[model samples]
Target: MIATDTLDTPAAVGSSAPAATPALPRGLAGTPDDKEMLRSAVELTRDIATARPEVYWPDMLLSAGLGYAALAGAILIGNPVLAALSGVVSALALYRALLFIHELTHIHKNALPGFRFGWNLLVGIPMLTPSLMYEGVHTLHHARTRYGTAEDPEYLPLALMKPWSLPLFALVALLLPIGLLIRSAVLVPLGAVIPPLRRLVWERASALSINPEFRRRPPEGEFARMVFWQELGASAWALFVMWWSATHSWRPLLIGIAVISLTALLNQIRTLVAHLWENEGEAMTVTGQYLDSVNVPPPALLAPLWAPVGLRYHALHHLLPSMPYHSLAEAHRRIVRHLGVDSTYQKGNYSGLLPLVGRLARSTMLPR
Candidate 1:
C-alpha cells in the first residue's frame, strides 16, 4: 500500500519539483499532478489514436473471451499438453485484461451504472481479485514511494547485508520468481493466521502505509472489510472453478485455477518491476509526491497484450490515479512533451525473464 507520506507530494506540468531520481532500469522521474498528466494524455491521444470513451472496450472483451475459451477448452480436453498451451494463451489474455482493469478503474462513470458494476463483477470474479483496491493503493504508491529510508515498507525492509552476506543476498535475489510463488502460495495465506500478521494483511488490503512516516488515519473498519471482500472474491472464484472441474471434468477446472493464480502472480511481479528500489530519507512535504512515481513502456509485444488494460504507461497512472487507464499512454506522452523524454521510458521492449531470475536480482518485488 502507498503510505500517506509516500503519496503526499506533487509534481506539476511546469513545476521544477525534485521528483524521484531514477536508479532502476526505467526512465522514471517526477511526480506531476493528475490534471497535468491528464491534459498531456489527452493531447497525445489526439496524435496516437482517438481517446474515445471505451475505445479499447471491444478489444478487452474479445481477448478475454478468447483467452477464457482457450483455457476452458484446453482443460475440458483433459490433455496435460493442451492445458499447458491453454495456460499460455490464458495467461497472456489475462495479463492484457489486467492493464484494462487498471484503465477501467481510472474511468469516470455517470451513464453506465450497470455497466460498471457488471464489468467489475465479471472481471473481478475471473481474476480472483478486486481491481478497485489495487487502483487506490497503486495511486498512493506512485505518489510517495520513492522517498523513504529503510523505514518505508514499499522500499527496503531495513537491515542491510554485511559484505559477507552479499553471496546470500545475491543468491536470494536470483530466486525471485520462485520466491514469489512461495510467497503467494504459502506466505500470504499462512501469515493471515496470526494477529500481527493479519493486521499487515489488513493494512495492505486497505492500502494503508505501515511506515509511520507514510501512515494515514484511515477508517478503522474499512480495511478489514476490504480484506474480506477481496480475498473472498478470489477464493470464491477458485471454489467455483473447483465445482466446475468436478462436473464437466477436472482438467479445465484445474487449468483455470492454475492459470488464474499464475496470472495474478505474474501481475504482482510486474508491479514489483516498476519500483522495487528507490527511496530517500528526506522529510516529506505535500510536494513530495513527485519523487515516487516512475514510468516505462513494456516491449511492443507485451504492450498490445497488456497496455490496453493499464500496464503500458503506468508512471502517469501513479501520478494521476483519476486519469482512466486507457488514456495513460497518451497522458504519459503529454507529460513527456513538456518534461522531455526523461519523463518517460521510450523503449517498447519487454524485459525477458523468469520469476526465479527476478527473485535472485531483487527480492523486494517479484519478477516482471
Candidate 2:
C-alpha cells in the first residue's frame, strides 16, 4: 500500500488562529491549511471516490479509436486543408488517450481490472509511452517530504528560472517523438547486449520526468517483470515501424510523427501551468503544495480540450491524489459549496490557462 502523510489539523473554519505554517526559502510558500476545508474535501466526496469502470472503458477506447481513425484520414486525404484539420483532430484525440497514463499511475491496479493492459495495447505502446514510464515515477511527486524539493521527479522551479527557459521548455517537446523512437528502436534493444548501458537507460532514459537530475531506481518484483515485457513490446514495435518505413513508405511515418509532435506540444503547454513552479527547493507542506499547484476550474471552456481527464483540477488532485478523474468535478463542487468563496481552497482555482502562463512568465522576470 502507498503510504500517505497525515494532514496537520488546523483550527476550524473562521477560527482566529491560523494553521501551522512551514518556514521555507524564497518562493511561494502558499497559504496555511484550513483544516476544516481539507476535512470537508474528504468527508463530502466519499460517495464519488470509487473509479467507475463503465466510464473508464468507453472514454479511453473512444479517444484512442478516434485518434487513429483521424490519423489515417490525415495521411490518406488528398486536400491540404482537410488533411490539416484531420491532423489537428488526431493530435487532440491521441493527446487525451495518452494522458490515461496519468490515470494508470494513480488508480489501484485492481480498480479497473484489465484497463492497464488494454491501454498499453491500444495507446501506450503504440504511442511509444508504456505505463512503466509514469507508474512508479509520478507517485513520488505526491510524496509529502519530496514535493517541490529536488527529489521530486516532476517538480522544477520553472518560475524561478531564466525567461528563456520557458520557451525552450515548450519548444523541446516538438522533438519528443523522434527522441522516443531513438530510445525504443535503438537504445533499448542495444542495452540487452550491454549491461552497463541497460542500467543507464533504465535509470536515466526510462522515466517521463522533467527534472534533469532525477534518476529512477530499478524496478522490483512484479513491476520489474512488467517492465521487461513493456520494453520488449515497445522495442519490437519501434523496430517494425522503422523497417516498414524504410521498405514501404516514409510518408506515413513522417506524417504520424508530425501529428504526435503536435500532441507533445499540446501536453507541454498544459504542463507549463500545472503548477506555479515557484517552490524552488523547499520541502513544502501539503497546503503549500496545493496552493503552488493550479486549478483551471469551470467557466474555462477550453480547458477540458487541452487539460483533458481530471487534469484541469491539478491543484485539487494534490489535495486528493486518490480521487478518480470523473469524480473530480463533483468533488470540487462539494468542497466549494462547503468552504464558501473566501477560503484557502478557492485560492488555488484560477480563471484559465493563458492567465496562469502569464503569471509564471511574469514571475520569471522578477529578480532571483
Candidate 3:
C-alpha cells in the first residue's frame, strides 16, 4: 500500500486540495486495552523477519520479466485488443515488482544486495520511483510517536474528509507519471547546476510522498552518492524515452508509460483501503495502530492481486514491520490460530475492500 501522506504545501500536481484540517472519525478513536496482546503477537512474529534471497529474487525477476514482456508485446503487436490486454497484465506485474521498495526500506542494509541493485536498474528507474524516493521517508511513518500524527509523513485520515475527496484520492495515481517525469527531467538536473535550488527540489520532488509539508534533507556520505546516481539513471531514461518518441517510434515508450500509469492507479486503490483511515492525528498505541489498520483474509483471492507482496496483510505488517513479505501469511495464521478470531490482533481484518471503502465513504458523508 502507498501509505497516506499529508502534504503541507499546495497538493502535488495531480492531488486534490491539500489535506484539510483532519477531523476525528466518530468511532474507535482511543487506545485499546489489549495493547499487551498486540505487542506479544508482534514479538512472536519477529523470528520470521529474515529476508531470503531465493524467495525474494525469483518473484522480483519474474515480475519484471513478465511486465516488460507484456509491454513489449503490446508495442510490437500493435493491436488495440492485445495492447489493452497486455497493458493490464504489465501494470499488475510491474506494480507488484515496484512494491519491493517497501521491503527494501524495512530490510536491513546488509540484506538482499542483488535484489536492491536489480530492482533499481529495472523497475525503479523505468517507473521513476528509485529507492531513494522512499528510503528516508518510510521510516518516519513507523515511528511510534509519529504514526498517525501530523508529523507522520505517510498518514492522512481520508475517511474523515469530505465525500468528494474519495475519488480525488484514488484517481490521483493517473497524474503521477507526468509529475514524476517533470520532477526528474527538469528539476533534478537543474538543481544540480544551481546549488541553492538543490534543497527545494530535494524537499518537494525527491520522495514519493503525500505530505506536502514534509521536507527531505540532503543525503550525506555514501547514500548521497547513491541518490545522485539514481537520479541520473532516471533522468537519462527520461531523455531516452523522449528520444525514442522523436526518432524511431513512440509506441514502446507510450506503452511503457501506460503500464506505469496503471501501476500507480492500482497502487492508489490498494492504498485507499489499506487502513480504516480512522486516525485523527492522534498518537496511537501499538494496539491502536493495529485496530486502525486492516487485513483482508482468506477466500478473498483478489486481495493478493490488488494488495500484492504481502500488502494484503497491511495491518499485520504494521504490527511486525520487520517481518519479510513471504512470512506475513504464516505469522497472520499463527496469530489467528493461537489468539482466535476475536483477538485484538484480528481487529484489523476485513472481509473485503468494498465494505471497508464503502463504510469509510459513508462515514465522511454524515455530520460528525
Candidate 4:
C-alpha cells in the first residue's frame, strides 16, 4: 500500500502506472454497494420488462400524452411555434429512446421481438437522423475508451488539440455539418455497394459478450462504412417524412430538416464539452464516465429524458450498462466512496466547462 501511494504521487507521473491503479482502475461505478443497487435495478427492470417490455409502453404512453397536449396547442390555437417547439422536444425524446435501443443492442435480448419492434418503430425513426454507421462506431468507443493510434469511430480527439487554435477548433465545428451530410447522403448508400457490413455488425454483437475488441482494437476501415450505412438509412427516412408532408409543402419539410440539423449541432457541442478534460493517451477513468458523456445533476426534471440513452448517470453507465439509469445515482455514491475519487455527474462544477475551453485552446501544444 505504501509503495502504491508513493507511485501514485505526482512525482511518478512520467515513470509508470500509479501503484494504486495497477491495471487501470476497477469498480468505477460498480463500487462496494454496486451489487445491491444492481440487484434492485435488475428486479425493477425485470418487472417492467415482464409486464411491459415492448414499446416501453409506459414511456410511450407518456410521450403520446405529451404529444397530444402539444397537438392540441398546435391545432386549436394554430400555434405553430408552440407545436413546433414541442415537436423539437419530442424529437429529442425520441432520439434518446433510440439511444436506449443502443443500450440494449449488445445485450442479446432477441428473445423479446415485441420490444425490438416497439423500440425500432418508435425510436428508430428519429435515430434515423444520426447515421447507424456513426453509431456502429460507438461500439468502438465503448470497446476502447482509452486513446490509441487507431482512430475509434467515437474518437473525438479534441483533448489533445492545441488549446490556442480557435481556427482548428472552428474547423472541427464546421466539419460536424459536413460529416453529418456525408454520412447521411453519401456513405450510407455506398455501404450497400459492399456486402460485408452485416457481417461486421454480427461480429461486433458477438464480440460484445467477450472480447471487448470492437472498441479496443477497432476493425479496419469499418468506421467509414458505418457512416455510409447511416447516410443511406437517414436519407431514406427523411425523404419518406418529407413526402408524407408533401402536400403540406416543402416549407415544413425544410423546417423539419433545419430543426433536426440544429439539434445535431447542439448534440455535437454537448459531446465536445463532455470530454474537455480528457488527455489523449490517458487511460479511461471514472471521471471520463461523465467527462466523456453528458452530465445532469439531480433536481433537473429533464434528467429522466437523458437517462434512457445512458447519458444520465454516467458513472454507473460506464461501469454497468445493464444497471438501469434509475439506480445510477446510488451506485455512483457507493463507487465514489469506495474508490475515493470524484467523477463527473450530469451537472458539473461551475468551472468545469471554462477550464476545459481554455485548456482545449492550448491543447495541441500538449505532449501526447
The lDDT leader among the candidates is: 2
Model 4 score (lDDT): 0.44
Best candidate, TM-score-wise? Answer: 2
lDDT of 2 by residue, 257-302 (tens): 9999999999999999999898868687788888889998999999
lDDT, candidate 4, 169-276, per-residue tens: 344443333344444344444545655654444345212121134432333485456444434456686556546776565554444444445444444444444444
Q: RMSD to native for every prediction? A: 10.2, 6.4, 9.5, 8.7
Greater-TM-score candidate between 1 and 3: 3
**What lDDT tens digits, residue by residue, belong to model 1 across residues 63-132?**
7787788777666667778768878788777667655555544555553344445555666545544554
Candidates sorted by lDDT, descending order? Answer: 2, 3, 1, 4
The residue-by-residue lDDT of candidate 3 on 321-368, one tens digit each, is 888999999998888888887777767888888888888888789787
Where is model 3 more than 4 Å wrong at Cα? 1-29
**Error in Å for residue 253 of model 4:** 1.3
**Each model's TM-score?**
0.57, 0.93, 0.90, 0.56
TM-score of 4: 0.56
Model 1 ranges off by over 4 Å: 1-52, 78-82, 109-112, 142-250, 280-294, 298-301, 306-308, 334-368
lDDT of each: 0.48, 0.92, 0.82, 0.44
Cα deviation at 363, candidate 4, in Å, is 5.8
**lDDT for residue 174 in candidate 4, whole number 0-100:** 33
Clashes of each: 28, 0, 7, 26
Model 3 scores what on Cα lDDT? 0.82
Candidate scoring better on TM-score of 1 and 4: 1
lDDT of 3 at 247: 97
